[model samples]
Each structure stands twice: as structure tokens, then as C-alpha cells.
Target: MSTPWHIQRMAALDFEASDKDSETARIVSCALILVGGNLPTDTRTWLVNPGIPQEPGAIAVHKLTDEHLAEHGAPAEQAVPEIAKSVAEVVAGGVPLVGHNLGGYDLNLLDRECRRHLGDSLEGIVRQPLTRVIDTMVLDRQVAPYRKRVSEEQGPYQMRTTAETYGLPWNEEQAHGAEYDALMSARAAYKMGAIAHTPYRDRPDWVRALRTNRFNSLRGVTVEELHERQIEWYRRDAEGYQAWLRDAAKSKEKHDPEAVIPTAWPLRPVPAPRNGGDR
Candidate 1:
């Protein structure tokens, strides 16, 4: 199949849940924005009834509560299938889903939510492997650290932060909604792709902020190559963070020294414990 890495066809996704723990969280909202003709050709949003109470902390982030969901949201049984259809349409049209931090969180939530409602994950529901996703979070962090300000304590790869660094407009006040975030993720990916392939000298002067960090390596690459490179980068990143935590002297975060972070590309199923209860 031909690659769908071009700006005019990259489909963007973002989702919100009822809680912070992806394994336990229920998806409350989902958004997909398809870019074509230099603008979104189609934009879809869904509000789902998670069938669980929304946590206060999570509510503060996306502002959907149990009461609100109960009153206005569609049941997961109804919403998940429709969501799958939207994704399938994009995939069928030779477009890949792209989003920031999507592989780390949103995809996991999607897998579990699909399992809950359809007895299988998205690939099962959509009836095709979702191998075409382009996670901008992984791509930006791996290929363009020169495009960000990362540190030992924090990698600084949040969507909004990356947007600001890449000379894309951002509004903290209007962020966190599924639709807003999904659109921004698409916009950010477009900016990143331009920087990667476009000659620095040819870009508009407004892109001067990223001129010095030219990523010519991303040019002339196939979509499969781009996807596989992210797998390597994400694995290295997770393992490196684990190594750092093991060596930190005064860290406040709790990490099990024996715990192994996932090296799998995109999302991994939550590991089952002894006795194989969840397996």
C-alpha cells in the first residue's frame, strides 16, 4: 500500500476518559479530524457513557462528570462501533491516524474500551490491523529533541508544549477538550512534518523558531520506515527512563526497581499477575 504520511491525508485522534489509570478508565469522549485540501475534510466527535463514575481529577481535566455523561452521552455499545467505523473509513482511504502521546495513552484506553464493549480491541472491531498510526509524540521526541526543551526530570513532550515549541499556536484556556486537542494534534503534526521535509530556508520567517533544528532525515522516508523508527525510539525512551529512575537519588516518584516498562510499540495490554487471573 502507498504511504499516507502527507499533510493532506493524516487523520488525527484524541480521546478522554473517566479516570487517569488507562487500564481502569472508561472512555468518555473521542474525536477524529481528517485533514485534506489544507483543511479538515471531516471531523467527528463522540460523547460516550462510560458506565462508570468519572473521577474528580479527570473531570477537572476534560470537564465531563458522571451526571453530565448520564444525561447526554451515548452508551459505549452504540458509540464504540461508530468510532470504529470512522477509523475504518480513514484507514480505507489510505490515511493513518496521527496524534501526540497517542501511543502512550489514548490507544491503550481504546484497546480496553473496545474489549469492554465488543469483547475485542479496535482491530477486531474494525476488522483490520491498525498498523498505520503515526504517533507524533513519539516521532517528535525521538527525531526532534532539537525541537523541544527536554530535561532529566521531564521530557517536555506534551502536545501543547510541543505545539508552542514548533511555532504552532496554542491556547491553554481552550485545551483538554477532545475535539480541541484532536485538531491541535493534527495541526502540530502538520507543523512537524513541514519542518522535517521542507527546506529550512524556504519556510516562512515565522517558522524561524524551528529553522535551526532542521530534520532533513525525515525526508525521503516511507511511512513504514517512519512507523518502525518510532518503535525503536519508544522502546529506547521507556528503557532509558527506567534506568534513570533506578539511579535517581532524591526522586519523589514511586517506581518498582524490578518493574519492566513496556518496550512494545504503541500500546501494550496490562500485564496479568501471578495465577493468571486476567490472562
Candidate 2:
């Protein structure tokens, strides 16, 4: 079997989108952080002028106001592709692009801008089957059984809640600045990766098995056969234990499968001793 890439490259992205309908055509803040391979640990940030006024609520969170953006920000057309370049470079480097909820939110916003600005260049790179996309939200749920996210415990920015269940210090006071968000996401990825204790950790065979679902069978038999045997043993053990539990529950006047057994079913009792002693 071919060895999986040891380099394990991943990209982390965050978008500080505008909340105004007028600025809907433009995004206020965008950033991408590439944290592996030959890439330098640099975060690319963009402040789009958006050609419209910023919403009051958005201004409260990110503090990128209409006046500030109009005075200092670049035009949306000029800024979007620069952001797309950051995305395209990381993706082209054979890295799986990751975000908190890439599937539902971030990628959509990215694709929208990519189509509007870069056109064909964006189409060639952004939308591909081999384009590895990892959603951290899905990964966390599968790994950790139960946990609730605290609202911006480690930062002041009111970002979406996450099941990450850990906190890290970030300069949230900087707020809505793409560079700060990208750096925070990079740090979050490192922290989450350390806690993901799945079978794939440091084990190429397990990763391959998980990806392919073609388990490694010992000796000559197929993995399917071995799996069936294991399942049968598990069922036998489970049934025996369950039967005992049912009987105990019935004795305590609780619901049990055996309690529903018809009277026709033989009920075994303790045998009498040879000397007529208590059995």
C-alpha cells in the first residue's frame, strides 16, 4: 500500500463578512492562514471598501465602519482576488483546506467572491473533487462525545459557537482585522489536532483502513469474515449479560424481556438436595 503524505498540510480560513444589505456585494474582512509544508507562517488580510456603508451591528463587533472603510479600504474587485490567491495557493500545494464550518458557510462566501472576481482562474482551482476540504465541526463531534461551546471565552469577538471545548488567548480587541482572525484559526487548528485521539493518529494503516473501509485481515481469511466473527462474539456476550439484567429487573418488579415470556415456556428452578435439605 502507498504511504499517505507525512507532510499533512492544512489551511485555516476565517471571513469577517459585512452585515449590511447594501454592502452585500462586498465582504469587509477576509483572511487565510497556511500552516504546513514549504509555506511561510504568514497570514494574508484584506479590507474591502465594499462601496457601501457598514451596518451598525457589524461596526460594534469588528469596528470596520463605513467612514473607515471608505477612507482606507480597497475596492471589492481589487481585494477579492488577492484573498482568492491565498486560498488557491494553499489548495494548489496539495493541502486540505480547513475551517470551522467550511461546508455550510465559509466556502460558500469564498466561492461567491471567487466567481465574481477571478472567474475562470477560480473555477479551475476552487471546485474540484480532489480538492480536500475538512470541516472541523464534523471532526470534533465524531471525536468528542459530549461538550458545549462557551461564547467567546478566550476572546472578545462574538464568533459562532464551536464544540472545541478549549480556550486560547487571541487579540480580539483588534477585531474584524483579517490577519488576527487568520492567526487565531491557525492556533485553534494546532490545539484541536492535539486533542483528536482517533485510530488514525501516527498510524498509516489505520488511516488507510478508515479511508477505504477495507480492513486488514490476518492469515488468509478476508477482513469481512474476521469482522463477522468478532460481531458474533460480542452479540453472545451482550445477550448473556442482558438476560441476567432482565431477570434482576423483573425480581425488582421492573420491566424485563423474560417477564413477557408465555407461561408455556419452561421455567427452571433450583433442584432439591438428595437429603431434602434447602436447595
Global lDDT for candidate 2?
0.51
lDDT, candidate 1, at 164: 76
lDDT of 1 by residue, 192-244 (tens): 77766777688556555553443665666666677777788889888876776
lDDT of each: 0.76, 0.51
Kindly give the number of clashing pairs for every candidate.
0, 0
Q: Give the TM-score of candidate 2.
A: 0.57
TM-score of each: 0.86, 0.57
Best by lDDT: 1
Please report, as a residue range, the 10-residue window in candidate 2 with the lowest summed lDDT.
Answer: 261-270
For residues 1-279, write the lDDT of model 2, one tens digit per residue: 322222345566777666632214357877776665556765667778877665678778778888888888889888887877767777666676656544435665666566556664344544543236554443333333234435435422133333223366544466446656555554554444443322434444323434332212211332233224333333443455466557765436553655322111011122345697531
The reply for model 2, stretches above 4 Å from the true place, is 1-7, 20-25, 37-39, 118-127, 149-164, 198-279
Tell me how many residue pairs clash in candidate 2. Answer: 0
